[model samples]
Target: MCNTVKVSPRKLDPEIRTALVDIAARLLAEHGAQALSTRKIAAEAGTSTMAVYTYFGSMSGLVRAMVHEGFARLERQFARVRQTDDPVADMLVLGHAYRHNAKANSHLYAVMFGGQSLAGFSLTEEDRQYGRYTLLTVVGCVTRCIEAGRFRTGDPLLIAHQMWIATHGLVNLELGGYLIDPVDADRCYDTLLSSLIVGVGDDTKASAASMRASRRRRRREVEAEPESVAHRS
Candidate 1:
């Protein structure tokens, strides 16, 4: 009788796991949920089907992890916005950061917010709360604005939700190509932000000034990007 050698499964590194998740997200974005499969993701990531099982347990788990990663990335970007004395301007920066994160990770964004694609995955309330935590930073900004008397006295959570509602609507429209011209889109976005700030009881002139400050802050960061990259290298 011949003794047969039994081979153990290969272990997955964190990088490989992340690669699988990214590949899965891209596949979903490019071809929709119907195109997502363990086999396809494995093939795309240059691994076997077992890699998917080893890393994520199942396709649903992979998708769930992908959604969480989407929120995690947004939170990272939000964290990067340095808080300023001017809460309104800081909040504007956070809004711009939100748009940046969504545009940068459109594949992950689709999976994060597209309910139909996640139909059978059954994301729990806790899973959604993971996404909501990113909004807490905005809530803090709103609270500061209220305390400073820059915004009307209101529930910070409600104000933050309204801000999210307005920003998300405009961003979705821009992403859907409804806002055709980039210049027009920027003008429209500035207008929406200004209107939202004014609606919260800030004067029109103050809102416009906050918008300008936010733009200046963003430009400084953009100009610093090359130096930051050099330091990293």
Candidate 2:
């Protein structure tokens, strides 16, 4: 007869619970949703299978945890973006951070957005509220833009939602390997962001042109550096 060990959530440290979720997220990313199982997650986490049940109650519970984790990480990344007097520029910075976060955590991003990734698990209202709150960060930035007379006078939430859809589509495509050239994808993202800002009645063309000029100047400066000096530094 095989013996099974039961683990109680009360006995497990919070770090252990976080570890289990992290392991599960990596598994989901590397192997896809169908490959997720309590036994596999337990082995990877170096804990008993009961640890899953103890911490999350069931697979659905685990999925919910993943969703929450994804949003929490996204929130942290957005929070790190510094606010500036130029609200449009600040919003663009936040957009870049959003893409960076999604790319860094593609598996978690999938679990959060991919409808079929969770299989039998459905996101509860609370899980969705967590996601909404993350978007609200962007909405706040957009509101700032409007207040600064950068964006057109309108509902900030609607404008933010449109921007989110555009940015999310780009990130999803890149993560899905649809964009093979990262440089081209990045250029496209910048163009898309510039266009969105312009559509909102901002003078993003000058900003975009200035950015290109700056990049060119930086490249020239680097190229002008003596090979010996470059090697030494």
Candidate 3:
């Protein structure tokens, strides 16, 4: 007869789970994806290796969760941009939110976009589907722009994709330090956004005005952030 001992695991703790993910994201950000390991993540998170297995099943799973979290944070930022009378301005704000999320979570950005680090797990069709949901918000904004005649009538999804491509290229470059300083990046971004808006059928002058409105609104939102946090506290 073989004797078997069933070892019971501790109840999964949400705090610990979040900590592990956060630690892994920071490591990925600081040292790139190859730096991630279960033992290293567990040590930094102050939990045992088993905790990672318990919470995320494996290192790949943890990385996958991190990618999802990145998208979730991006969506949250998108949610903050309230729709206004100007769809063009609103769309630009959403683009700014996308860039903000990327810079704020620089570690997870590459992973979310299929970094070389997804060694064990391949993103399934479902994962791709989940990621595309973020674009829907952009599409909706594009649709509004079309309806408002701020943009030429075209496929909203295609327009959104073009916008995303332009925006992501600029942001990825900025994050990689291609653009010298914040001031330079901002200038480049404004230039790129203005060109994109014009390319999509808006007049150059109107595009410039919309960009100014977007900047002013973003500044107001930035100013309100501290008060918003204090109120929550």
Candidate 4:
């Protein structure tokens, strides 16, 4: 008769937990988002599957963690551009930075922008606000150029979309190696951006639009007073 007892599970360190999550993120950045899973991530990190669950709720939660990580990396990349005091120059720098990041992290970029696994993951209100606000940072630069009589003002958001699509298209094409010509991809992107800057940076009517918006806000305020008084009655 031998005394046999079951051995308890190995204890996981906090450092190991962090490493597991980081490995999952790197996997997402190297391969595609689909390649990420609790089993695989834990296997890579040399941790038990239970440890993955203890740290993150599910695979979806892990993907969200990766998404959050990607945004931080993107913001950090854009933060490195030395724009000094010129908005036009700042935006040009940011546009280039966008391309650079997408190129460097193609897999992560696909996860962020492509309609794949991420399609199932709903973006939270914070995500929506972050995307909208970050886009505005560049749009505001364009608006500043317009206000300073540098660029023509139509709609900053619309113009920002143009820039966004332009960079996205180029990066997407380059990522898939779909460029028909043998020319350097980076050079082509630079040329495209330069053309857009010249094309859209000639309007200077933003100040007029701002005045109109201010007046509209004042009118709305005035209109609200009567409505509130009527409601009180």
Specify the highest-TM-score model's number: 1
> In candidate 4, residue 1 scores what lDDT?
10
Clashes of each: 0, 0, 0, 5
State each model's CA lDDT, in order: 0.78, 0.74, 0.77, 0.60
TM-score of each: 0.87, 0.82, 0.87, 0.70
Candidate 3 residue lDDT tens string, 50-69: 87789888887887888787
Candidate 1: residue pairs that collide: none
Residue runs of model 2 more than 4 Å from their true location after superposition: 1-10, 115-119, 180-183, 209-233
List, residue by residue over 110-198, the lDDT tens digit for candidate 2. 88865334748876677788889998988998899889887779999999999999999999888878887545986887788888888
In model 2, what is the error at residue 189, expressed in angstroms?
A: 1.3
Q: Alpha carbon lDDT of residue 187, candidate 1?
A: 79
Candidate 1 overall lDDT versus native: 0.78
Instruction: Mark the 10 consecutive residues where model 1 has the least summed lDDT.
Output: 224-233
What's the lDDT for residue 153 in model 2? Answer: 94
User: What is the lDDT for 87 in model 2?
Assistant: 69
Error of 1 at 149 (Å): 1.0
Q: Which stretches of candidate 1 lie over 4 Å from their true place?
A: 1-9, 180-183, 220-233
**lDDT: which candidate is best?**
1
Candidate 3 C-alpha error for residue 11, in Å: 3.5
